[model samples]
Target: MSYFPAFLKLDNKKILIVGGGYIAYEKLEHLLDFSSNISIIALELSDNMKRVIEEKSLNFEKRGYQKGDIKDFAIVIVAVDDIPLQARIFAESKEYNCLCNSVDSVDYCDFIFPSYIKKGDLTIAVSTSGASPAVAKHLRKYLQELIPSSIGEFLQEMKELRKTLPKGKERMKMLDKKAHDYINTWSSK
Candidate 1:
């Protein structure tokens, strides 16, 4: 089945991650790019995980995840290797109406993380409906190379134009022309 694509505003929202090993650490790294309001629950943390927590100054509990640990969080990521625990947390997350992702277990996941490229305010997400993550990653990398480095600057210029130009059909036409011209020029580089 195909999943809907949506961008969430995560500012001030609570996010819970259950685990602190290598898999959890990987998820944490990706999450850090989008939000800082994350709390991790784990029995023990890896060195890299500890460093990220300390650097970000995130909320953490140094113990095993409890039955009700997913409370009040907007999103919950279960990265533990134990399948039963992943399933249990995913099931419990539903009680709190939280979106849950059980890392590699698609059966218990409410959503899956997509491979993405972030350039300044621009974000492009690539997904294959949980079919092949490797392909998604490769596509993201290809897109990253294909996109021009000047795109961020171009976006900033567009933002300025949007603010300065008055609301009218003329403004829309001008903006459309500018975007088309910029893309045509950048694609040649």
Candidate 2:
């Protein structure tokens, strides 16, 4: 089955990563784009992982994952290569009311990470339901190039206008036209 696409606001959510290898590092990099409330528990951390942990001042445990390691997290990512370990963690995550994502293992994943492009407030996600991440990645890159770099600033202007304008259909129509015109102008250049 296909996965639903939605955007999550990670304002106060806590995330956990149960690995310290390169794959775990990749997950960490993606999570860091949206949140910093993350902790890791793994037997050994890669050098790059250790550096990022130190730089971000994130909590971590060098020991192997314990039974209750995921109890306080809202999302848990099992980046370890062991399928059994991922399965165990996925089951445990259910008891803790947390979402689990096991890297490269769709059977153990509550949700798959879609390749995305983020430009300030704009984020576009591309997914193939775990079929072809390479295609999704390349599509994301192509979409990114098509977007103007000043989109964030333009959105900020629209935000201010919305806040100042009174609520009505006129306001909605005006904003819609403004956005449509902006996109058309950018594409034309």
Candidate 3:
């Protein structure tokens, strides 16, 4: 499947996670960096997962999946290993018209989570459409090594400069040239 690139605004949004295993913990760790309003519903939670819940003060409900658990959530992440359970959650999430991601199961996912490299506000996400996660991970590793840590600062600088530039085709041309020049200078130094 051809995937479109999009950025989600999850700040203060309610997110639901339907598992507490290692995969669930990994998903929670990633989400914790974005939103604090996360609710985890699972039959049993791992020690590390419980610690994270307590530390983040996240809402944790010790229960099995229910039909309407995903009703009010903006996004639902199903990290459960059971295919049947994942399918059930995916179906329920569709009824609520919310985005759902089933871990390692692209067929059940509304969107696939990419292997990402995050440095400050700069995030580089690499995905291979679930064809090969290892390839995506490898690409992420390469990007991590190639991309400078100062990219976040550079992006901020560009944003600030763009606001002051004239608004027209000229502005677009100037921005493109300036970006190229900045990258060239950055790599040379």
Question: Candidate 3: deviation at residue 91, Å?
Answer: 1.3
Report how far residue 148 has shifted in candidate 1, in Å: 1.6
Q: What are the TM-scores, per candidate, against the unseen true structure? A: 0.96, 0.97, 0.89
Compose the digit string of candidate 2's lDDT tens values, residues 37-93.
999999999999999999999999888888888998999999998999999999999
lDDT of 3 by residue, 24-68 (tens): 999999887678899999999999999999998999999999899
**Which candidate's lDDT is highest?**
2
**Residue 112 alpha-carbon offset, candidate 2, angstroms:** 0.9
Better of 1 and 3 by TM-score: 1
| Segments in model 3 whose C-alpha atoms lie over 4 Å from true places | 186-189
Q: Count clashes in each candidate, considering only residues at least 3 apart in sequence or on different chains.
A: 0, 0, 0
**What does the lDDT read for residue 155 in candidate 2?**
89
TM-score of 2: 0.97
List candidate 2 stretches off by more than 4 Å. Answer: none
Whole-model Cα lDDT per candidate? 0.91, 0.93, 0.88
Candidate 1 lDDT score relative to the true structure: 0.91
